[model samples]
Target: MRIAFVHRRGGDDEAVLGQAAALGRAGHDVHLVAADADDLRRTPGYATARRTVTVTTGHGGDPVAALRALRPDVVHVHHVSADPGRSWVADWTGPLVATLHDHHPPCASAGLHRDGRYGGSRGARLPLAWASRGGTADDPLLRRADRLIVLSETSRARYTRAGVAPERLALVPHFVPDGTRGAMRPEPVWVYAGRLAQEQGITELLRRWPAGQRLDVFGGGPRERECRAAAPDSVTFRGVVEHAGLVRRLGRYQGLVLPGRFDDGLPLVYSEALAAGLPVLAFDGSPTARTVRAEGTGTVASWDASLPAALRAASLVFPTLRAHCRARYEETYGETQWVTGTERLYAAVVRAGAREFA
Candidate 1:
């Protein structure tokens, strides 16, 4: 079968590349059409695509024509929305599978975070973001898809609450490539490996990070400069590193700190950390936190008065959790499961025809 995988940006580019390579290895012809070549070059296995096309916009005649020229068996789309000028893939026939990586359609902030917290009022910013040239809700596009894939149960609940049919949503975890499992460091050292944004609560973590604890921050974002400037001596900013490089670095850390306050779907960083045999430290009740607690892969607590104590407690169990983290990744979020689940979904979508719900 021939498949055309479409994505506008790089957020889930790694996963797309993994799926494409998996499909190719399974003898299915796969084509990747993206807006950037840099994203494609970042990952190792993207060369598996039978063809990789670079497009300016999905709505443009060039992208649509390129896709149409392929005559794909099924078109798997990620992060395509009808937001004005960014409206890529207006309307395509046949089986269309869309993955809702976040809460972008129902809530403009995507993670439903605003004013430095989750589910707060976006206030004036909401309307402005919506009215902007590149602003459009994906509800309509999601409704049109033959199948809708979500990364976690939290995401499914959020979308279902926003009026997407539960039947249309499938819970699929992100793929984590196997990584070198490292021995837990004797010293209690942790790393925060994600964007330094307001919703992520990195600022709060930096402010509250215990004096004795050592934290090495990774990834660069809009708030990088501010964070680095305000961060204490215990905190070191490593800026952005390549994905493989980040995984290699993860092997050296005793624990991974995900200070995010939002309900993240299966976070790639969390999975990568676990794959590298590191337990996670996250806020209580958030998706990653819940998984950590449930799987005994790490500890969770409120970021307020309870965080410092939680950090100390997690460090004690770090070695035990390290084994579970590696085992959990192998059993659940690893490449084999992702490829199998994705291929099954693609086959189901193609067989069911594009069913429209009223």
Candidate 2:
């Protein structure tokens, strides 16, 4: 089967590509399309088609043009908010699958971190999130898509609540690559990965970071400078790294510091940390964090009013956290399970003709 995977300018390149890589290796001739060239180059075996469009618009013709040439059996699109690339799905005769990587369609800012959290509060900040956006989910362009791929059951529930046909929704979680690094050192070092974006809660983490333990921050984003300035002397900033480097570099840390107060489905890094046999220090209220705890993967902070104590406790539980983290990674975020679940969704999509059938 021939497949066409389309993603926008920026995102987790390794994760997005890893999701498609298994399909390619399974004998599918995969052609990847992205606004940026670098994002596609990292994924092996993908015939990349670069789309050049500075602004987000429903009319970008690059994706449609690329689809025309590939004659793919399936077109999987990521980050619909950046560029729904609805044009390709609009005219395509094949199945057009849009992955709900973020809550972009109904909410703007893609990640949905509107006024404060990543859930992007509704009301005033909602419109602001979509202000300069070229198009939104309610647009006729997105409504024409053949299917919607959501990474979590919760996200799929949102799509259902938003009136998307139940048949159109499939929960296809992202896959984390195997990161074989040196054994975790016996030390009290905490690490943070992913972009230092607003909703990520990195700024809040740094502001309230405990004084003693070594905190290594790895990632670069709009909030980098502010986070750095506010970080305690114990915090060390390690800018963004390639996928391999990240896993190896982050492995030494006692655990991953993920004080995510926002919701953008799930950060692939959390799973990566777990896959690396490292625990996580996620916020107590996060939906994903709850999932992790329920699965016995990581520990969650219970301090709503006492964050300092929570951080201190997280530091102490580092040993047990690391064990549980690896356990959860294998049981849930493991590559085998991810590939199986994703392949099942792809096959289901291929067999179904319309949303009702899906």
Q: Candidate 1 at 186: error in angstroms?
A: 5.8
In model 2, pairs of residues that clash are: 112-120, 114-120, 118-262
What are the Cα lDDT values of the candidates? 0.70, 0.65
lDDT of 2 by residue, 1-358 (tens): 6777776644445456666666655555766666665545555323321221111222353566666666666777765342333444555666777776665345455554421233334674555445425444545345766667777666777667767788877766776766756466746778888778777778988888777868888878788889989998999997867757777766677777787776546777777887778877777667667766776655677535566777677667677666767777777777688767766766777787443212
Model 1: clashing residue pairs?
Answer: 58-88, 59-88
lDDT of 1 at 22: 68
lDDT of 1 by residue, 1-358 (tens): 8888777654566677776776777677777776564555755655544344322234432255667777787888875534442344445666788877664445456534321223436584565356432322344456567778888778788877766788988888877777674554535578998778876878878877776779999887678877877777888888878778788778788888888876656568888887888888888767888787778888887855666788878888888777788888888888788878888998898888843311
Against the hidden reference, what TM-scores do the models get? Answer: 0.82, 0.77
> Backbone clashes in each candidate structure, one number apiece?
2, 3
lDDT of 2: 0.65
